[model samples]
Every structure is written in structure tokens, then in C-alpha cells.
Target: MFDPFKDFDQAGYLRNLYGEKDPQIVRGLEHTLFRTGLDEALAHVAKRRTLGYSDFLAVHRILFSAFYPSAGQDRAATVPNIAVSKGNTVFAHPLDARRAVEEGLRIGQDKAALRQHPGEVMGWFAYGHPFLDGNGRTMLIIHSELCHRAGFCIEWQRTRKTEYLAALNAEIASPGQGLLDGYLLSFVGAACERQLWGGAIDGIRGLDGRSIEDAVDGEYTDVRVMQKYQAFEMSRAMSKADRR
Candidate 1:
């Protein structure tokens, strides 16, 4: 079992409402509910005049409230003492998760910046790694909305999962390098109507975000974990300087 939260006994497998232990079974149900939740979330966001950090959490709530008791709660609030990572990427410390997400939104909301630095914005969101689950789907919906407002959209249909994931991972490891932006630029196209986006998103593969199963967990206070996060910060700082 990939227990990223390290509270499988208490949280019941990422705090799922059903208390499901089987990954495969949980995923099956996730897909079904995610579809329904996506529609609701899209509607909720559509009504917003401007997206903000709170909207991000609201999206998570709308997407998984039925399935997860901690749906809208950020890692800072729910798992502040636990460190989480996926593969080689260490996410922002729980205390900094909110800042990471806010940074992404700050850039993504600017149409010009988003067009030129979509990857940077995406990297921040991925780095934020807010909720224990549903981070992927929540961000995608918000991203699509940002794209729509900006007059362009990523043709996710053409982007392969492996290639996209590689770019995402690369962006996380080396922020502001344009690795993801360059890859995503090729797939950029005219934005579709918002009403049509629901179906388009639903058709895309790997919407689950995969952080739930692939994440490696450690206590935030662990020396190794602290080092990994500190290293991530140092690397990010160097990358920021390089961009300047």
C-alpha cells in the first residue's frame, strides 16, 4: 500500500470516505466520482469572476468531498508534520504549500505570463502539492480555466502521459528552466468554449494526478527529509538566479 499520509489506519487510505484498502478498487471508484465531480467543479469555477488560492481549495472540495473527508484541506493543514515526495521530486514543505500554490496562481492569472511561462506556473502548482489526493485533476481544471481566459489551451489529447509526466518532473526538479513550457508550447492551440471543456478534460488520460500511489513519505523532522527539502529550495534558488 502506498500510504503517503502515513495514517492509513486513521485516515483510512488517504482518508477516503469508503475506507477502501485496495488501490485498484479505490482508483476504480475515483474515476467514476471524478467525472461527476469535474462537472460540478467546472460549474463552480465558471461562476467565479477571478480565481484565487481559495478557489483552488474549493476546486478540490468540489472534486472529492464525497470521497474524501479532507477534500479541500491543504497539506499544511492536514499533514503539516509529514513530508511528501514523488519519485525524485520533493514537494514544498507543508508550511510553504500555500505559498507555492499562490505563486502559481499569481503567474497563471496573468494572460501574458501564462502564455510565456505556463510551465513555470505549472511547476509551482506541482511543487505546492497541496492536498494528499486530487491535486492533478484540481490543477488541470483550474489550468484549463486560466487558459480559456488567456485565449489558448493545451491540447491535452495529443500529449502523451509519459512525455507530459517527464516534462512535469523535469520542471519540478529545475524550476523556471522552461522545460515544461517549451514542451507544452508545441501543443498550444485556440481555446475551446468553456461549456465544451468538461468533456474534453474527461477524455484525457491520467487525470488522477498519481501522487497518491507514487508518493514517498517521511516525517518532516527526519534529517533525510529535511535535507531533501532544503536541497530542493537551494536548487530552486539557483534556477531562479539563472533565469535572471
Candidate 2:
């Protein structure tokens, strides 16, 4: 069996990926060394480096800054507040981080008991908005990780935006019926296919006004790329699920 978590040397991977001379990479290395104790963070950085996927806008910045805050700051500062949205509905109430963490752990550990469906999990977290920042990216990472661990591969690359959005909307509107689970399973199936096919399938497109095709064309292509990407995603998902 392939160990997804094996040999994750975070510092080395970060330095290599961002290039040893890049200031941002240097700062990220410094921050990780100083702040987080989580053994997986560096591994995630390495995995992402292998995949060539840039961090989602805010999430990337937060990750970098956490390791390298302004001059006098002790650690990356906590985000001020988080706002969650479900289509037209939005909530600004304070999220109970501890409660969210506990629930996340429960969801991950008791996958069989919950017979967990993706939409409920997605809705629960999206609505919960546990982190002050990185909610969307974090949710995606966490959800993907659980499905992968459970023997499914969620291919965000192949997921139709309309379907993905619909599942999210359904969860926000109804919160039950398992709509998200079905959609996520389909996505997993697609991802697995893409992995087997070796880049014949187009990866995620339409993020940040760039299509997946364009993103791939603009960067390096290697078989290990998507594998690494999947690993990073799995890490995020597992981490979140364990928190609950």
C-alpha cells in the first residue's frame, strides 16, 4: 500500500519548491519552524509543491504570514472574524472553534457510524465556519481527505461547477437528503479516473478566471504532480475530520 504520509520533509520540500532564494519561501520556512508543531504542515507544503497548485488566494497568504508575521508579532495573528454564506443567506455570529474542532474529529473518526454523506459534512462545516479565515479552502481540504481515506478519490478537477455549487446550495437550503454525498462520490470517482488516466482528464478549471487547462499549460506537468496534490488535499481533510 502506498503511504500517503510517508517521508514528508516539510522544510526541505518548501525550500525546494519555492526555490531556496525566494523570500516568501524563506519566510514560510521560518514561520513553520517557529510556530506550528503539527508534523504534517511541512509535508503538505511539499505535496503542494509537487502538484504546482497555488494556494487559494486568502488561504495561501494566511499560511505564509502565519510563519512570518509583522516584525513584533509573536505568531501569525488569528483572523478577526469569519462570515459564512449559503447562497443568499449569510451569518456573522461567532463560531465555537472548540465545538467545531470536536465535531470535525467525530466526523473523521466515526465515518462508519455517521455513514457520513459529503453534503451534510460540507454543509455542517461551511455553516460552522470554524476558522476565522481559510474556511472555504479548509473545508475543501478536509472534505476531500475524509473521502480519500474512506477509499474514494474526490476529483475537484472533474467536478462540474454547477453540480458542486448545487450541492453546496442544497445543503444550505435543506441540510439533509444526502445530496452532497452523491456529488462528492461522483467527484471521487472522477479523480480516481484522472489519476489512472495520467492527465488525460482536465483538472479543475474556472478558478480565478483561469481554466485548469491554462493552469497546467502555464506550469510544469509530471505524473507525481496530481498525486502530490491529492496528498495535500487528503491531509487537510483528515486534519479537519480529526478535529471534530
Candidate 3:
């Protein structure tokens, strides 16, 4: 049971408004609640002319505040002393999570850059792993919007989960590399209208793909944890330097 917050009141799941304690049941309720909230979330994103870190937070808040009380709060502010990881991949430190996400936003805001380097922009967001929950869905919405603004969108429906995940994981592990970029380029197509995006988002297989459940938490002060994060920072720095 993954409990990154260490506040799971029941069955490794965070406390929810429905008062569900069973992980299985919570999963069902979560899916329903999130779907119920998608229209609002998408509408909110559609109205936004510009995307930023705060807008990213707002997406999570819209989709999850009805369920998780900590909906919009990010790791950097809410869990600053914890380090989060999935399998062998350690994300940015809690304190650095916001900055990492901001880096992605800065790059994505450039329409030209976003069109050319969507994977690198998304890699920073994934590595940042900002929110305790709903990071995947929130980022997807933000990413789709950015792509639309850039005059193209990924044909996510045609992409295989396993392959896409592998590429995404690689991108996060080594930013500035074209691993994900190459994988995603083939799927790029003319942008769909905003009104039709709801169907596209709904067609997505897992709303919270690879949900936070797979994330393991550790003390930020742990020697091994600190070492892992340091390595990631060093690699990120090198990637940036190379780009410059």
C-alpha cells in the first residue's frame, strides 16, 4: 500500500469525502468523482488563454477537491520533508517540486518550443511530480491545452500504454534527450477543437495513469534518498548546460 503522505486513514488510500476506507471501493469512487468533475475541469482549462503552474494546481483542485481535501496543494508546500519516487525513478525533492514544474511551464508556454519539444516540457513536469494525487490527469490536461495552442495535438488514442510509458520514463530519467520526443512525434496531428477535447480526454484509458499509488515515499534526509535526488539534480543541471 503506497501512502506517500503517511496519512492514509484506511487501506493505503487517502481520506476521501465519501468516507471510503477500502482501497478497491475508493478506486471506484475516485473514478466516478473524477469523471463527474471532468467537464468543469476541462471547461476551466478551455477558458484559460495561458497556462501556468497555478493553472496546473487549479486543474487538480477542480477535478479532486470534491474528493481529496488536499487537492490543489503540491508536495513542495505540503510534504516538503518527503521524497517521492516510482520504482527506480526518484522525483524532484519536495522543496524543489514547484521550481521543477515551473521549468516545464516556462518551456511549454513558448508555443514554438512546445510544438518542437513537448516531451522535454512534459518530462520536467513528470519529474517534478508536483501534486500528491492527480498529477497525471492534471498534467495531461495542461499538456493537451499547450499542444492545442501550438496548433497540434498528440494522437494519444493510437499510442500504446506500455511504449508511451517507457518513453515517458526515459524522458524523465534523462531530459534534453529525444526519447519521448521521437516516440510522440509520429502521433502529432492537427489540433482538435476545444469542445471535442472532452471526448478525447474521456477516451484516455487510465484517468490517473500510473496513479500515485505506485509512488514510494522516503524521508528527504535519508542518506540514500538524498544521494538519489542529488544525482537527479546533477543530471538535470548537465542537461540544461548542454542546451545552453
For this target, which candidate reaches the highest lDDT against the unseen true structure? 1
Overall local distance difference test of candidate 2? 0.41
Ten contiguous residues with the weakest lDDT in model 2: 211-220
How badly does each model clash, as a count of residue pairs? 0, 19, 0
TM-score of each: 0.95, 0.46, 0.91
Residue 214 shift from truth in candidate 3, angstroms = 3.2
- Whichever of 1 and 3 has more TM-score, that candidate is 1
1 against 3, candidate with superior lDDT: 1
Instruction: Compose the digit string of candidate 1's lDDT tens values, residues 47-152.
Output: 8998888998999988788888888899888878888887777888888998999999999989999999888898899999898877788889888888888999
Better of 1 and 2 by TM-score: 1
The regions of model 3 sitting more than 4 angstroms off are 9-12, 208-212, 239-244
Best prediction by TM-score: 1
What is the per-residue lDDT of model 2 for residues 58-103, given as tens digits with 9 covering 90 to 100? 3334443443232111111232232223334332223343343345
RMSD of each: 1.6, 16.3, 2.1
Per-model C-alpha lDDT, please?
0.84, 0.41, 0.80
